[model samples]
Target: MTRLLVVDDSALMRRLLGELFTHAGGFEIAFARDGLDALRQLHEFQPDVVTLDVHMPKLDGLRCLDRIMVERPCPVVMVSAMTAEGAEATLEALSLGAVDFIAKPGGAISLKMDLFGPTLVEKVQAAARARLPKARRLAERLRLHRAEPRPRLRPPPMRPAPAAPVGLPDLPPLPALPGEIEGAVVVGCSTGGPPALDALLAPLPADFPWPILVAQHMPASFTGPLARRLDKLCALTVREVTHPVPLAPGHVYIARGEADLIVGRRPAGLMALPAPAQAEHRWHPSTDRLVTSAMEPVGARRLVGILMTGMGNDGAAAMTVLRQAGGRTIAEAEETAVVWGMPGELVRNGGAEFVVPLDGIAACLLDLVPAR
Candidate 1:
C-alpha cells in the first residue's frame, strides 16, 4: 500500500483529504497539524508521499519541505489557498523540492470538495510512485546532514548553435515586421518551460504591444504560484486569467488546469476564455485550443505561436492549423530543451518556421513584434 501523510492545520481539510485518499484505496494515511507535527510524524510513519499546506503556524510549508527533502526526500504535494500569495508560496515549494500541489477551494465547501478532493487523492497516488532524481538526492543530503559545506551550484554551461533556418516549406516566410503583430501573443509550453520561459521573457522590454496568453501544462494548483513567479521575473504584468476577462495587450495571462484557455474576440475586444469541462486533449490548457482561439481573433497578421519544451505532440497538430491560418510559429530548439517532444514534433511535422534556443527566443520575439 502507498503511504501518505496529510499535513494541514485545518482539521476539516485534513479529515476530508484523508478520507478521500482512504476511499481511493491502496493508501495508508497519517495526519499532522503543522510542519512541526509533520516532522514528528515523518520520523514515525515514513510516508511515501506528503500533502503539505503552505500557511501552517510555527513552521510554514516551505520550511517543512526543506527538512523533508533533506532528511527523507519523499514526494510532496503542496496544498495552497486559491489566492495569489498562496500561489507564490507554493511555487517556491516546488523549486525547493515539492513535486506538485492542489489548491484548496475558496469559500464553497461543496464546490471546492467536488473539484479538488478527488484530484488531490489522485495526485497523492502519482506522487508516491514518482522517482526522485539524483540531483535532488544530492541536494537533500547536503541540506540535511552536512559534514562539510557544499559547493555552490554553478549554472550549467551554455551550448551554442548555428542560427536556426528562417524559411521552411511548410511554414510561412518570415514576416517583414517580426515584432509588429497587432493582437495577443499566445504561447504553449510544458515540461522544461519554467526555466525556458524565464530566459525567453527576461530580455523583453517594458511597454510590449500585446497581451500574452500562455497554456502551460501543469497541475491545477500550480499555476497561481507559477504566474506570480513569472511576474517577478518578467517585465510585463503576469497573472492567472480567471473567467470572462478580455485579453488585452501588455498583460501576460496564464491558463489554469481543469480547463482549456480559449480566446474569443468579442465586438469589444479579445477575451480570455476558460472551460472547466474535461480536458479535450491529454494536456490541460491545451496548445491546440490556445492556438485555435488566437487564430480566430488575429488571423495571420496578429497571431504568434510558440511551442516550447514538453513531452508528446500536444501542440504539433494545432501549430499546423495556426501556420495554415498565416500565424507566425516558433519552436524551442533541441539543444536547449529539457525534453524536445513538443518543439521537436512541431519541426518534424513542418509546423514551425523558426527553431531557436531558449536564450535566443526573446530576441526573436522582439524582432518579430513591430516597434510601437
Candidate 2:
C-alpha cells in the first residue's frame, strides 16, 4: 500500500479526502488538521506522498512545504483554490518543489465530488511514484532565477510573410499551409513545468531570435498569472495567447489554459491563435496538437520541439514525427524531471536529438537557435 498523508485544516475537508482515498484503495492514509499537525504526521508516518492544502492554520502551506522539502524531500502535491491568489500561491509552491497540484472544488462541494475524486486519486498515485528532484540542480535553477540579466543585442527586423488568404477563418481547426518561417521553437511541459520553464527561459537573452510557443497544462486562472510571472522574470516578452497575435523573435506565447494554441498564417504574419481543445487530445493545451499544428505552418526543418518534466506521453508521438521529418527535438533528462513520462517517452521512441538536464536546456536551445 502507498503511504499517503492528507494535510488540511478543515475537519470536513480532511474527512472528505479520507473518504475519497479510502474508496480509491491501495493507500495507507493518515490525516493532519493543520500544517503543524502535518509536520508531526510527516515525522511519525514517513509517508511516500503528501497532499497538502495551501491554506491552513498553525502554519501556511508555503512555509510548511519549505520545511518538508528540506527535512523529508518526498513528493508533495498541493491542493489549491482556483482563484487568482490561489494560482499565485500554487505557482510559488511548485517553485519550492511540490511535484504537482489539483484545484480545490468550491461551492456545493458534494456536487463536485464526481468530477474531483478521480483526479485527486490520479495525482496522489502519480505523486507516490514521482522522484525527488536533485537538490543541486534545483539550487542552480534558483540561482539563475535570481541572477542579473545578460546584455542583449537589438533584434533584427523580421521579413514579412504573406497574410492568410481571404475566405478563411481567423482560427482554423488545422493550420492552413506550411509557412516559410525562418525558425521557431515549440515547448511542451506539465507536472513540474513552471519551475522548469523558469530555468529554460530565464537564461535566454532579450534578443534571442526565435518565437517560443508553450503548451503547459493548467486551468484558465493559472495560465494568466503564469505568463505574467514569466514575463517579469524572463528577458523575452512572454504573453498568454488569447487572440490572434503575430509571432515574432524574442517573444514567448503561452497557450491559453483549456485551449490548444496553434500557429496559423494570417494577413499580418505567422500568428499564435488559441483554438478549442480537440477531444481526441487527452491533455488541455495539448502538446501533440500544438506541435503538429506548428509543423503545418512552420515546417519540421524550421521548427524545434522540446519535451520537459511532464507526466504522461503528451508530446512524445508528435515530437517523434518532428524528428523523423528532420526537425530538432530535446527531451529533459530523467534525473531532472519530476515525472519523466513525457520526455522519457520521446527518448524511448528514438525522437530526441538531445537529452539534457533542466539546468542545461536553456543552453541547448541557445546553441540550437542562433541569435539574429
- Measured by lDDT, the strongest candidate is 2
In candidate 2, how many Å is residue 53 off? 0.5
Residue lDDT tens for model 2, 19-137: 99999999999999888888899999999999999998889998899889888889999999999999999988887889999998779777788899898899889888888754435
Report, for every candidate in turn, its global Cα lDDT versus the true structure.
0.73, 0.84
TM-score of 1: 0.63
lDDT string for model 1 (1-372, tens) is 988898999898888877788778998999999999999999999998889999999999989998998888888888888777886776667656676667777896545776777777766765665544222456544442332222222233322223323453344334334344466677888655565565566567667777788888876767776786777766677788777786655678889865778888777767888877454688887888788767866775577788887767887888866766667678887776656778888888776767877667776676667656
RMSD of each: 7.5, 8.1
Candidate 1 ranges beyond 4 A from true positions: 10-12, 40-47, 70-72, 106-114, 128-173, 178-184, 189-200, 203-211, 216-229, 239-251, 255-286, 300-304, 307-317, 323-372
Error of 1 at 115 (Å): 4.0
